[model samples]
Target chain A: MLSINDIHVQVDDKPILNGITLTVNPGEVHAIMGPNGSGKSTLSNVLAGRPGYQVTAGSIRYQGQDLLTMKPEERARAGLFLAFQYPVEIPGVSNIYLLKAALNALRKSRGQTEVDAMDFLALVKSKIKTVNLDESFLYRGINEGFSGGEKKRNEILQMAILEPLLCILDETDSGLDIDALKQVADGVNALRTPERSFILVTHYQRLLDYVQPDQVHVLAGGRIVRTGGPELALELEAKGYGWIEHLPRETGP
Target chain B: MNHSLTLDTRLHDRIPHLPGHRLDWMNQFRQERLAAFTTTDPGGKQDKQWHLSAAAAADATDPPHLDPAWLERYRLPDVFSLVWVDGVFCPHYCVREGLPAGVCLKSLDELSDAELTELRPDLTQPGLQEADALMNWNLAWLQSGAFLRIPERVHLEKPVQLLCITTAPVGLVSLRHVIRLGRNSRATLIHTQTGQAGASGTTGETTAIWLEQAAVLAHYSLQTQPATARHFARLDVATDTGACFHQHHLALGAARALTDIQIRAADQVSCELNGLFYADGNRQTAIYTRVQQAGSQGITRETYRGIATDKAHGVFEGLLQLQPGVRKITATLQNRNLLLSPQAQIDSRPQLEINAEDVQCSHGVTVGQLDEDAVFFLVSRGLSEAEARTLLSFAFANEIIGKIPLTACRDQARQAFLAALPQADIHQDWL
Candidate 1:
């Protein structure tokens, strides 16, 4: 479903990801593990077509199309979602309003009619339940004055509502307590389908404990140092990334 | 009759024909104000704080017939309303049904000589009198307006709406409004000024409000004129001890518009000022507010938001003055602005002059473009860049628009504000 070949990314003339290569089949959940400033978030952002992240070298293909050639909104309409590590608080824009606008935009891009108001509200109400948020939250400004855990849950709520094809959770596990972590993991697991793919970029293994990944990749010095089965996460958690810090980088698939 | 003549000169020639001209005190008042306006420079120079030049008032002409549907668009249901067409009060369109007893509402021309004489002190109160040239000019040409008064201890349930519509093609519309609330009385007043598309002239409005002890007054002013029109409005408010005053002003239209609001608060009085101004497509909108805490233990809060797009210009100047010996006063002022285009410009100045001890005062002003991160966040949700920006800009202005206390008025202001935004065609459900 997605291919990253020798991707080298730079932000503001500073290289963040160097010669990275990876591939994911449909329905595969890949856990990208790294230390601080190790470029895990950069890869997620690059995949989502965020601006200011220059793909200096290499190519990315999503659904057999050039992902780099698409605008952020274009990528979004094509079913690429990125749950931000630190979601921004947009005052005066209600959560439900944004959700409706986003869903309608995606539907319009696919030449579908707009969602019925009653149906949309019902969908939102059901989806919000999975994230453990009150109905009042949908009326308030987007994440305005929300607690840290609530903000993260709101991201999941949006994800559940939009139902993207390729989801990238950028540090979504951070700042979330154990309860919130489980709720988010359940939300993600419920949305997983045989045709959907997920890239979970995280710094900790706790989230993995809740949502099992198909593969685990340890990244260091802007390159993937090792790739293995889900057991790699347990190993990394035990040894704490230090044992693999000096490993040689993988060439490619 | 020369349209090119200076405003003062025109007023000088027309003073004899203006209403109340035969009364000696009224004549003296108009002459003195005209002199004051003439001596004060029409400020557009570099040294002046004003950023826009006042448009010359077009010669008065017979107002055009307005469609009922058009009039209904600006009317609020179940309220005592007065309609003004091209600076002239149209009694036929006035709605005064169910007006409570002990309430007085009348057109300035309808006021008897005795009423005018009794209100002379309030008309010329030194605190309400500023050296502003446009305000002086408004006083000099004041012929049409509404005067509303609520008697002591009487809480008026129905709001009073003063609707002014301009339909004279390139004609001047000048109005003056006076509101006085007696002790412990409460009232809501909505003042809306709008001009038809074909009407492109200058409008001058001045409102002087008096709130007696423990009275509560909620005043809203919504100005949405045509793109080619010029609007200048001034609000002078004075409150007695323990009174509460809430003022919401929305400047959403006009090619060049400036609103000046001045307030003086008495002991333990509370005052709140909320304002939003949007300028687009070479239009210029400005709001200047000065609030003075004249008595001890008063409270004042001011919040203003401005949006300028596509070579438009917006200006906000707020001044808070805490008089000496006014202890335990709390005053805060916040002004936030957004520039939607590279060529758009916004000027925000918040000044505080405190001469009292034991007072808490803070002021903050922010001028910035839409938050790029927030824009990306929205765009990443499948909305196009234009839609994202429009939504964000609407959100920015909604911070102030959401504070309008009256639902009907707020809805009207919100719709007007949304329509003024660039790419306002975004689905209404998203707002």
Candidate 2:
């Protein structure tokens, strides 16, 4: 479903992700594990087309189309979603308002009719229930004054509502309690299907315990040094990223 | 010394003499104020209050183009509306019927000698003596305005809407409003001023409000003059013990606009002043507010936000003064500004003077651009960059617009606000 070939990315003349390559097929959940400053976020941001990041050399293909050519909103409309590590708090812009705008924009891109208010509310209610958030959250400013756990859950709720084909979780497990972690995982599990894929960029193995991945890749030195099955995550959890960091360069694929 | 008080030769010649029967006290007050006004330079740099408004002293000598249709655009239902057109009272647009008992709403011209004398004390309270030249100018040339009196224990649920429309392209429109609320009275007053697009004129208004014990008053002022118009407005308020006063000022359009709000609170009184201003396309807007806590145990809160874009310049100056020996007073002031374009500029000054030791006062000011990460977040959610910017700007201004006491006014103002944005595709329906 996605092909990132030798994507060399940098920000502000400083290299972040150097010669990184990965591929994921349909219906497969891929977990990219790495130590601190290992370019995990750079890869996610590069895929999402965030500004200020320069792709020095590489090509990213999503469903056979060049992803790097699209703007951020176009990427979102094209079904590429990135769950930010830090969701912005937009005051006076209600969460529900943003969701409706996003949903309609996506629908417009797909040549579908805009959803009515009643139907949109119903859809939001169902999705929010899956994320275990109160209906009152829809009336509030987008994530304003929300707790850490509530923010993560809100991200999950958005993921459910948008239902993008390719979901990239950039450290979604960070700052979440165990209960919230499980709730987020369960929310993602419910959305798993043959046509939808996920790239879970995480630093810990605890998140993988709930939402098991088909493949686990160890990212060290800005490259995929090791690629293995779900057992690799358990092994990393036991040995820690310290062991991965000291491994020999140009190891495996 | 032939020290007769004088105005700028150009401005004095353009402004007509005060109309109606002027009482001895009113005449004396005007002369004293005008004398004081002549001594100080208009928009003096020596005074911190007038430094930002120095360039707003333009001449208004053109004829008035009175059109009734301007008032029709912003009319609300169930409102006792009064349309002031180009320094004149348009009887065809005034609606005072169906007023509740003990509620009297009329123009100064409609009141008799006896009625005017009865309201003399409230009108001549020495609220703003000589601190501002425009205040004096308003008193000297007071030609048309509204006067309202609410008796004791009376409550008027419906709002009184005052629409001031100016079609004059180089004329002066002076408006004076007096509102006297008896003990335990309650009312809401909305004042909106708009001019024609090509109109080159000046609008100076002075609003005096008296709130008795336990009285509550909500005052809303909206200034939307055109690019060729200059607007100078002042609101003077005095609240008695246990009274509560709420004021919201929104300045959306003008060539150069200055709004000064001065408030004095009595014992245990509460005052809330909020303002939002946006200036673009060479427009300039200045909001100056001063609050004096005279009586003990009073509370005052002020919040003002401004947005400047496309070479527009905006300024906000807030002063909170706690009188000496006034115990248990609490005051807070906040000013937040956003510069959307590189050429846009903003100057925010929030000051506090405290004489009483046992008081809690705080002030904060912030000037910044829209958060880039926040913009990206919204963009990642499928909104275009322009769409994201519009939403953020709308949200910034909505914080103050949401505080409108009436839903009808809120909705109307929200629509007007959205229309004022530079984006052509942005509208209320889309949001």
Candidate 3:
């Protein structure tokens, strides 16, 4: 469903991702593991069309369309989602209000009718259970004073509501506890479908324990150095990223 | 060659026909105020922030017919309303029925000699003396305004709504309001000022509020004049022992608008002031607030937010003073602003003068553009860039509008702000 061919990314005239390429088919989950400064979050941000990340040389194809040419909102309407590493705290916009507006905007782009208020509330109430948040949370400002775990779960709640095709979760499990990690993993697992694809960008293998990935890619020095099956996460966990940093870069697809 | 002299001459020519001109005491007061206004130097000419033009004042004739639909938009539901059209009270539009006992709501001209004599102290209180030009001008040309009074131990159930509408195309509308809450009394007042399209003159309003011992007063002032209009408003409040005062001021319209608020708190008094100002286009809106804590154990909190887009300019100056011997006083002042365009500008000054020992006072000021990360977050959720911007701007202003205690008043303030916001297509329900 998505293809990145030898993409070189830079931020502020400094090269971060050098000739990195990856591919994901429909219904597949790719766990991108990396240490500090490995460009894991940068990759996810670039995939979601975040500004300030210039793709110097590469091409990204999503569902047969040029992904690089689409604006951030256009990419989002076309089913691209990125769960930020650190979610922003918007003080005045209520969580539910933003969710409703976002859902309506997505639906409008797909030429669908706006959801009725009652139906929208019902949907939100049902989806909110998956993230284990109270109904009162919907009335508060978006992550205004939310805890780290709550912000992560709120992101999952939004993902559950929007139901995007390709979800890129950037460090969603960093600050979460064991229970919140399980809840988030369960939410992601429940949303898995044949038409959906996922990119789980993380720094540790703990999140992979609950939600197993189909492919595990060890990213070091801005390029994938190793690729293996789900057992690869356990291998990396057994032997830390120190060993992976010395491995030769993989030249395979 | 002097602008104040020219304005004085023009006003002098119009005084003979002004309201209350024949009343001996009222005429004497007007003459004194006019003299003070003419003699005051009106400093700060070198201050770029003082952009008020002397030519904004003009002579007022009879106003044009006001549209009922326009008036209805600002009318709050289930309240006793007193409507003023072109600085004159309109009895046909005023809702005077069902007023509770011991509550007096009347036009200044309608007050009997006894009532006027009783209210003289509050009317002649020393507040906003530094703004001699505007204050004295308001008194000299005081057309007509409302006087609200609640007796001791009386609690008003329904809020009183004061609606002032300006329909004159080019004229000055000067109004003076006196609100007195007796000992242990409680009341809420919603004061709204709006002008019809093409009402391109100046509207000056001065309101003085006196709260006796243990009295509580909640005041909401919303000014949404025409884009061509110029508005100057001053609010003075004094609280006795244990009295509480809460005020929300929203300045959302006019080409040049300035609001000055001064408050004094006695022993153990509590005061809260919250405000929001939105200025777009070439509009200039300024809010200056000063709170003086003169008694022990007084608590004061002031929060203000401003939004300026296009080439609009916004200014917020908050001053908190704790007098000597006022122990255990707590005060906080915060001003946050948002500039939406490169050309848009905002000046926020939060000053504190602490003289008493064991007093805690803190002030914070921030002037910044909208959080770009927040904007990106909203945009990545599928909203267009414009929609995201409008929503964020609305949210920034809502931080202040959401603090209004009354639901109806909050909704009215929200609608007014939304209407003033640029590129605002987002629905209120969506927010």
Candidate 4:
């Protein structure tokens, strides 16, 4: 199981993740839905150990190990992957290199041999067919000048390649269209396993139809204010966070 | 400082020994090198280390020499080689055969009296004050010359290698070379001068070379001298109408190496120049380059890359001049430098002089360390800091090194670059 225990996180001197606690067992997907300014993205970033997010007080445990103690890469090596909200455009470094380097780093951590050029190319070709990305993107600098949808799809491609145990996807469906969203969802679904868990951070219930999370949580004022089964996403999508805003301030954060 | 820099005495001695023409223009040129040498205040330009006599004083160590025994290890495979070792030509070797018909490749000693006469006067053309000093200094100490002349429309299959081997026995070792590729001719020369393997604390080496008319030449000069060796070389090229010229100067090592490369194009000519300078340890290297468009419709692009660490200092000064009436000229110059250590310093200057409004010219210069965001991104992606920085630096140099047409030279540049990085410092934080 992956769990965040009363995490208190701040960014640039402002509190964002205010003592928020959430959990997900193996084979369970939890959708974190929130209003625009309610710190939905902050929760995802804090969980992934993104730089600049100060975790003042919190204990995040994954598979019974202290998650916060690990460096971002070490956490990643320990099977924690975060699909970033804004994928950086790295010029002159081909996507092929990024994928291979990431895979080999993880392989090294696992006490396995690194993939050679030929085998790595073969692996990427097979995965490329799934995302429907052209071979040219493989040669282009990583995410450099890629379209918004293409960038999001690239994140999904990285998720597919690394295959982490606990995946925290931050707003992965924001810029994705119906077709791209479906492809991305299909790719994520293809990697579903009883030993893996996912924490999907999205503001809409639209993606939940394809991803089908086991639980849904509402984060308001940097705290989880509401929790329910998968149907909570549809209810919140239909009614919106306006109803929650009218609730008592003492209820969260 | 006000003394006229005259090379008359040096030219008088060299002209009689050189093989060139007896034209009146030749005499004018001989007088010019002398006048420029005598009249110009070569010492007043106290800017970068181009002042030959200035650098010698600042450096306390004995300058480089021409130790033949030490030069044996620095030889390039399967190419004709020549050198003015310690200002003296030693064990000279030249291939007079298998050259393309109308092709001429020989040392200054091997040159016939007639051919030597033709190159003598232009060797010190007018407006070449500092240039004349460079040639005069070489003439004063010249032991031999590796001269290559390609006749009109001749194209050679293999490149010619000119190796100037220098060792630090006395003070400074200076040299000169003239590679003239004729009308519609195409050739490439890999001119490399290395320090004698086992030398004193440090040494300085200066060399000057030129290429002329409708000649398609790819001039490559590389220096991997020790961090204790100081090298200074000025490469000045004046191309004729419709000539195409390209040069790649690489200085990965050299305790102190100051290189200046200037390419002036005749009307309708084009040139592409690129350089890579890297220094580790306390090594210091400086580069100054200018591309002057003389004729109309000329084009040029200049790029310089430097990666420095461990108190290493690098300086890059570039000038792109599009003279009046040289309309429709397109020029671009860029100098990008990277500093690895906190003490590593780089002073880069990229300039543009456009007298013609119709010309399209632009220049840019940047001196910075590896991008922090890029470094963190690579590290977060599980790359060691050393691996990440080296990869980034190599990527910065790829555009320049990738263009090297020769397979072997390009490979050497990449290998040397990767090997110059610090291994101990990168893994410090990994644990």
- TM-score for chain B considered on its own, for each of the candidates: 0.94, 0.89, 0.94, 0.80
Superposed model 3: Cα runs more than 4 Å off: B1-19, B45-56, B128-131
Q: What would the per-residue lDDT of candidate 1 be over residues B205-239, giving only the tens digit for each residue? A: 88889999999998989999989888888888889
Winning candidate number (TM-score): 3
lDDT per residue for candidate 4 within A39-134, as digits (tens), equals 988887666666788889979898888888877677777887878777877664577777877888889988999787678778888888787788
Give each prediction's DockQ, rounded to 2 decimals: 0.83, 0.69, 0.84, 0.28
Is 3 or 4 the stronger prediction by TM-score? 3
Off by over 4 Å in 1: B1-17, B44-55
* Fnat of candidates, each listed: 0.85, 0.72, 0.82, 0.25
* Clashes (candidate 4): 27
Error of 1 at A176 (Å): 1.0
Off by over 4 Å in 4: A203-206, A235-253, B1-97, B126-129, B132-136, B165-171, B196-214, B424-431
TM-scores, all candidates, are 0.96, 0.93, 0.97, 0.83
Model 1 local distance difference test score: 0.87
TM-score of the second chain, cand. 4: 0.80
Give the C-alpha lDDT of model 4: 0.70
Q: Which ten residues in a row have the lowest lDDT in candidate 2 chain B?
A: B45-54
Which candidate leads in lDDT? 3
Candidate with more favorable, higher DockQ: 1 or 4 = 1
* Candidate lDDT values, in order: 0.87, 0.83, 0.88, 0.70
